[model samples]
Target: MQTVGEVGERAMIALFTAAAAERSDNADDVVIGSGDDAAVLAAGGPVVVSTDTAVAGRHFRFDWSAPEQIGARAVVQSAADIAAMGGALTGLVVSIGCPPATPVDRVLALNEGMVRQTHRLGGRVLGGDLVSAPVVVLTVTSLGSLADLAPVTLSGARAGDVLAVSGPLGGAAAGLAVLSAIEHGADPGLAHRFSALVDRYRLPQPDLTQGPIAARAGAHAMTDVSDGLVEEITTMAGASGLAVDVDSAAVPRPDGLDALAAELGVDPVRWALSGGEDHELLATFAPGDVPPGWTVIGAVGDAGGGPTVDAQPVGDLHGWQSFSET
Candidate 1:
């Protein structure tokens, strides 16, 4: 187990470059690959860009998550932002910071995870920088192209639009709760019974394909559910100058959540509303225009100034804030 200090920066860069080169399905816009000062990419129409950072202990625990899982998570979340804008991915630029004592194999595994996830979306890593630090930090910047379609903005929702989601929600938040319980010495059988929730938290499978699908289907507004469902809907409503009315019963909760919530003695509906990081696509569409995969959970109404569920304003609306004391 060689440490990063022993391998040195140049050697580490070579290792990462080789790993990135293994991804064969790079987009045609990737004119220049890794091992350069900067990557050169071709742009056609509007270029959508987004960046996200994940810090160890804050975003994840090394003891609970494999290095690859951490890496995959960082990539997926950043890529989901591009998808929210209804763009097809072009490439990614990754920058990693870790302690010198970190194992070289761990860094390599992290890169492998990034490669695997990016390749899944028909993209590849262009280049990145590795720096010595006190803790593990990964920053991924994703670039995408909108082709001929207009990029969906959060303010495009009309008063009569329908609010829909591309996939299930609340699974990641439940997974987080399960992991915390396991850390506090919960029964192993509990973990075995709800392994799917744990896996959802470990590595979220965001429906990246649906972003473009929703855009093509005439989605007026869109955003990713990285924050809790209510928090994001509030943002959309505020931006669009409309009130969003959510049918509490119509909101899609993940499978096995009711049983798990009962065991934990918590409200499953609250989890679905407030639990963040599901990374599902939340979009607004005209009546009867929602794509086949999206589930209509609510509707937009005349500006009542905020979001309401079951015709009542929600209290305690909060999600994954970078500075919140959870």
Candidate 2:
């Protein structure tokens, strides 16, 4: 098998550029696609840009996920950020740092995954960088067009607003638990039983369309649930200078999660509240303005307190922290 080192940097660049060109839809916004010094893109309004990274061993294990899944996850991480801002995706710039011994095909496969994801959001791969690193690292920068709409930020929420989520949560957390179990020799059968959860951890499918929908429906504040629900809401509360009350019964959980959690001897709701990486859009809307496809999980209240579930403070709920030890 040919390695990246054997193919050399220039050849790798040529290969990636060709791959991007083949997948490009030639959107009107992308004046110049990949293979250039820098991409030129047209935007009608304010642009929303977000960058995210995935590192080997920490974010993902090569043995646990395919290269395509790794690449797709990176795109999801940044694209969801644009969506949370109520913007339409315009383009993505992806950079990769990998050891020379990494297989050339793996990197190409990774790019293929990113291109496919960008295409789903009506975007193109504009440009990126390649360099040597200790481990395979992917950094994707996603750009979106606001289309003249005001950006929905975490600070826009106010007292008495309805707090909702675009889709189910806890699936990714449940999946991670199952994967950990399998890796530790708990039971190989668990993988077959909970493939959906495993897939969620590998590549989260956030509803990019719902962000704009909520925005149009008058969302006051919005954010993608990259961190756990509790952490995300608390942060939003702090930013907005308000308190939030989450209805424990209203939190959405993926089907069969409770069963899996029971089998694993865990509290499923804990995962729903504290597990992160689901990427579902969480937003605050007026009482009468909550849009379709969103579940009302809580309500915003006055300041001087933190988030609560069942009217009690959430104690020690933890979510993904990049710098914290695993």
lDDT of each: 0.89, 0.89
Residue-wise lDDT of candidate 2 within 234-319, one digit each (tens)? 88988988998889779999988999999999999999998899999999999999988899999999987678888898888767
Clashing pairs in 2: none
Pick by TM-score: which candidate is best?
Answer: 2
lDDT of 2: 0.89
Any runs in candidate 2 off by more than 4 Å, and if so which? none
Per-residue error (Å), model 2, residue 225: 0.5
Query: Compared with the true structure, what per-residue lDDT tens digits does model 1 show for residues 285-305?
Result: 999899997889999999755
In model 2, what lDDT does residue 15 have?
86
